[model samples]
Target: MITLFRSFFQSKLGIGITLAFLGLIALAFASSDVANTGTFGGVAGGETVAEVGGTSIDTAELRSTVETAYNNERSQNPDLTMTQFIEEGGLERVLDVLIQGAALVEYGEKHGIVISKRLIDSEIASDSNFAGLDGNFSEAAYASALRQIGLSDSMYRARLRQSLVANQLLAPAFIGSAFSENMAVRYAGALRETRKGKVVSLPSALFAPDKDPTKKQLDEFYASNRDRFTIPERRVIRYVEFDASSLKDIPAPTAAEIRARYERDADQYRASESRSLTQLIAPTEQGAKAILAKVRNGQSLAAAAEGTGLSPSDLETERADYAEASNAAVAKAAFEAARGKTVGPLRSPLGWHIVTVDAINSTPARSLADVRDEIVATLAEEKKREAVNQFAEDVEDGFASGSTLAEVASELGAEVKRTGPALSDGRIYNTPDSVPEILNPVLSTVAVMEEDSDPILAEVVPGEKFLIFDVAEFTSAAPPPIADVKEQVTAAWRLERGSVAAKAAADKIMKAVRGGKDLDAALRSLEKKLPPIEMVDIPRSALTANSERVPPPIALMFVMAKDTIKKLAAPLNVGWFVVQLDDIVPADTKRDDPEVATFRTNLGRGAGQEYAEQIDNAIEAEIGVTRNENAIRAVIEQLSGSGR
Candidate 1:
């Protein structure tokens, strides 16, 4: 059901419909009735961020909305930072959505568009989130879910009421919309258009200087881009890890314990009956009967199947248990048939099948001795995990009671480990070996912590160990002497010079092509210095920005006038390419084409949404909308946890 819902939501028309109310739904789930304490016309109340018509949008509500939006984004991308969230305009987006919803609600109230209490109650009662084990609405479950998110019953209902009213007001605009077939045909034709072109790449390696860079040239390059050579702040982290694998005192499981476990889970060790089956599906009942008769008369099954004109793959030979077979009738016949016996001309949903049981496999239960060692190892690991968890708790308690990491390690009789100075990006200086797996948590912890702060506890290896670490010393970012980075500077200088030359060559080729010369002819002029040119007919859908056959700038071809030449430098230090548009093939726009229908439906929904937005804007203008800029900025800072 969830998969079905997602498929519906992803359809072309469904996408536009969802966009119309997606923000409203998000705001509804994130909002509460904190604004209800003040009257609709009140001038003073709790801190307010905005006013729609005469109603105030409280600061508390806006903060909750931002936090919810941030959490939703982070749930999709776990590594997203608060700084990145703000930089992506998460706060402004949420505010605009909430404000738009507010405007819709105000307009609804003025026009007397209201949802009944019974309707709201029915909607809440049918919600799956409020359903209990018996699949009935449970008040306790409903209250608990709302409480977990800091929403009261009245607050939740108010948001729902607003959503219902807005839906009612917008339904007319969406339902009354229509799109023409001509418009759909035109749009789909543009999307399915294919372009045939040739690309000639100018490799930068061909333009490399024969000699190494002079000292003066290297020094000059380093002087101009010294900031690029500056190293970020590095930290030396000292830590002690409590590892489960280091527990040596756990006792092995006895024979009796192993036997008891085997008995408790005996069904898991039992194997189902399986058969090796080779089946030949016939196209007709008469053909199947003929094949079966041939097999029964001592002809080989493969030979009989070949007479029916079925390939080896079409025969579908493999091993399967009763449940694993393609259909129930085939499974039952295969299991019941004697080994080396041929059975069927049985009609399944697919076709008439004739099967031969080549082999039958039966598994017998084993004695406890067969798995004694595995059980013993499992018991030992469980004991070790418990011991490690206890030690981790003790270390955490020690830190809480004012003991340093070193002191805690001493108390536990564990050795403290120190890492070499490492940059914030996790690079260690002058180290021959890579960073140990266990030290990853320590590096991440110290990267964000203030210098000389208290030791922090973290799970370095989930379910196996914990690390207590602190930054022992810190080194701020600074540029090293040019002599120290001379090798790197020389490589950078060469790459820069090579890239410039490649672009210059590509530009010359582009100029020639624009002057009526063929692409191959233009490249042949520089044949000694260029690689072989490859041409491919790329459909518009296949011309993605990340295509391996074409550079990202190939997207420019669609926008350029036909028969024009263009040049683009490749990303990531690759060479440049000169591209020319040859011809375009537009899609067929027959009435029966599925793409045309989809495009028509999508365009209609898009037009409806545009009309809806215009309605919202006109409503806002009719009843003035004012916002408190200072309050909004303060709320943003608070949600980001950088409040001054």
Candidate 2:
């Protein structure tokens, strides 16, 4: 699947360039802009990675950007390593983005594009990382976040200015651009082309070593493919939780306060009568009488109103309130009506009211003593909530004042607990181990947090429950000792050996078929009985029509030259395939074909991206990008800890 997408991205469309632009912009916005001046092991801080015109990108800057990108990727892919990240073009992509950004900035300056300080300030203020509890920008939070990342305010602003400049320069090129009709038609025609092929599979198991590998051989295999056996970084989380019940000594509501609360809402305790009415107001008295007559004749008030293109609504209101809203006469009629009875076509400012008394509720007035107990309970709850909030704030302040998790836990009389090592995605590192459900919310929080840094207080159930936690033990990602995974390593070794033999066999089969022997005859010529050759007929459009993964053998046949046979290795050391392309059929498509219009529309959407790429390329060419290969390599090595 990865190969299929890679092939498409690398094709004539060059979709990867557009994707690179988008991904880089997202990374630029998300990445911490702190320029770390710290040395990376043996690599000097000032070493140049690349120079765009007269601007130099130092090793420190590159390391920080690559590290941020690696960390971002690692959060989603917990097992990802710096080495794997670099291998998968992480280094090149980040370096290319850096170079492009520098080029854009330099070119923008020459062309009078200016990114204002106000814009950069707005960007910084809008970042959620610097937001406070009130959900607004906080200067203290911004400063604290910068301090944690070792990025000074000035450095962050400068880096932000560059990104803003680049966006200003490229955004215009991304609009109002499109591919030509001829180019669109040609692309559409290519999609309609078809190919016929034959594929023979040579299974690795057929050539695998029957005997077990020696201990030395197993060790060597484990050493070479250590990444396969390595585990993702995991941490033991330590935390203490507390809620409202934990805050003791909350003052009970006093008699005076309860009395005051009762007096404040004295009107609620007064005698009153309210009617629940479903009514419809008509345009005239005759219409109201017609509706009332229908209600009397077995139809519901709502049903009767429906005939007049109107609907009856239900509302419960006190007599005085209803009178004020309508008129005294209408209210008197509704209030006088018995429960489940329909009342008159009474006149009001809102035409005439045909009302149904759905229900009539009566209340008797009460003295202050009657609701005093209820008021006390309400006031007590309010006091407890306020105390709980203050307690939480005090705990946070304690941590902010250099207090440890254990110290805060001791003060609160809460037990500090340690969880089994867990991954960023909240899975137990040891499959058999488990932690209490209460700790789940904090696993992701502590995953990216530095070990032994300040503990954080997180709410588990909003205002009701909370947790204060920190990383107690941190383990870096690396392969375990060979002895622990000997059996698994031995199996892998056998598969690797088998795959090599299978590839050799596939080569022979390819040669036989290319030299005029039939595919089945060639397969029969091999010593081992292989899987039978399967013939495939596929349309080029079919490869991408449903967005499904095309089998590697079929995918390989599509890209192969007609009348040629080639050996292609299957993924995961599964087997080897001998693919023979029998014929290629050019698409017989007209200029007015529906597919042509479809492709034109699709390609037109990406025209702006092509324009942006061209603009970027032109800018780089004009500005002259000079890379220091040795320095770049050193920076990657330092980030991967290989230099150490």
Candidate 3:
């Protein structure tokens, strides 16, 4: 049966049909039932963790998958630790993916969806992972890749066969799904509907008291919300940087070496002449000669080409090398023509041409004495880079041997830079403008470290420099005394009281509007002074209009029924808003829109995905699945070093 299935697909669809299975198996595990718990009753540790039908997912398989994922992530983030990976739920994600793949494979077997060995071979042969330097399948390369990931050839082939079967089972679910035009129109109408409404904002500034808060009131506010005034943990770092720019006392180059370099690059130093030509091509030699006669008689190229019905762009007018001219004949005439001379009724591939030499530019080569300083500076910079690289290597070796940055700096005759206490947000207590560029990269690397971590060496700018740094002092987060920030506390207290007053006023206005009062009249009755009420049409999507003035209110207007009023807090802490839903304009059903077609295609895809998930869930439930906690815990401990 498997052989018959492969023969049918090969004769009907060829390589294209096999290529479609490339990502289908991965998609089966894209969403998983691993998040749903099953009764933990099965084999012991280091054995099978779960079973779908007759297929078993053992501890060894789960461990291999987790280790592969961890190594891949570690390649990009060298600092990632096993403890951190386990804490972030990486193990659970891999377990879910493995279980999901096993479930699909079981379903395919029951449904009699056979995938032949030949199909699996074809897929593996086409995979670039198994290809050699010459771009052909190599058995040795395939064996090496599997060995690196700790997979035997038979195990790898079995996994590939399972994926092919899973693809065969799930492909039919979405391949033929379609959505109707009416369904698309209805969905688009809801998204395209617009509402006209009026909004009134009660500004908090209007409700502020005339006088500042008393000390007693400020103290009470600060004591109750002390956490708001707390500063986060900060650090003071000290480091020494070794870079090319710090290299000094470089030796000067000799005159003999400078002259030798100039002679070696003699061709590059030689100059060539270029001419700007305005040319018009004609169909025949007689027509070209006639145009050349007119241009020689004081007619401009533009006026002469008017009869040819060609624009100025078609008549080439740019500078080019003599070798780059239109043809051999045109090249000879263009170089020989004197400045402002008209020449050429020359014939070639692009017909006959009438040419004019507009201008000639000439450049002379510079003598060795003229460029001596430039050559010397270039050589000095090259030497400086080499010296800096050697010095950085020495610094790294010293740091590895438990030497302090100060000791390294003393030996190398370099100065050490120290930073004042600064928050993680790059805010310093003092000397804001003097923040060194080296501090940022060092701080980012150490941000994940514990307080007072050991000094380490890091490359700040790749191929440029390295920094040796350690946390000099660390300060945990703590609230400042009220006396230290009394003015700031007083301002915050006033805003809190004003927000209360503004909310009450906005609610009153909304109450009036809901009770049949006009929107404009409700704003006039408010106790606090408010902004002018403006009525504008706002679309649900708001793709075209600038709705920044009252974005939250506009968003609420669409969800509310017509003739309803709601009050909301203003965005960005401005104040409060009273909004009324005046009217709604549904999308026009009679007109055909291009966006509606796009909407239909997207909806069809979503419906197909939901259907596929339902099918997988049904199959999984029917087959029954059981997971063993002991085996799972054992695999997690082995891979992540975490027992839980």
What RMSD, rounded to one decimal, does every model reach? 15.3, 16.0, 18.7
Best by TM-score: 2
Error of 2 at 290 (Å): 61
The digit string of per-residue lDDT tens for model 3 on 334-376 reads 7788988877788764456677787886767777776677656
TM-score of 2: 0.64
Going through the candidates in the order shown, the clash numbers are 0, 0, 0
TM-score (all chains, Cα) for each model = 0.50, 0.64, 0.49
Model 1 lDDT tens row, 291-329:
889888998766665423342222322233332324677
Q: Candidate 1: where are CA atoms >4 Å away?
A: 1-14, 19-49, 58-64, 74-88, 200-505, 521-534, 541-551, 568-577, 587-598, 630-644
How many collisions between residues are there in candidate 2?
A: 0
Residue pairs of candidate 3 with colliding backbone atoms: none
Residue 388 displacement in candidate 2 (angstroms): 14
| Deviation in Å, model 2, residue 328 alpha carbon | 57
Sorted by TM-score, highest first, which candidate order results?
A: 2, 1, 3
Residue 198 displacement in candidate 2 (angstroms): 2.3
Could you say which candidate leads in lDDT?
2
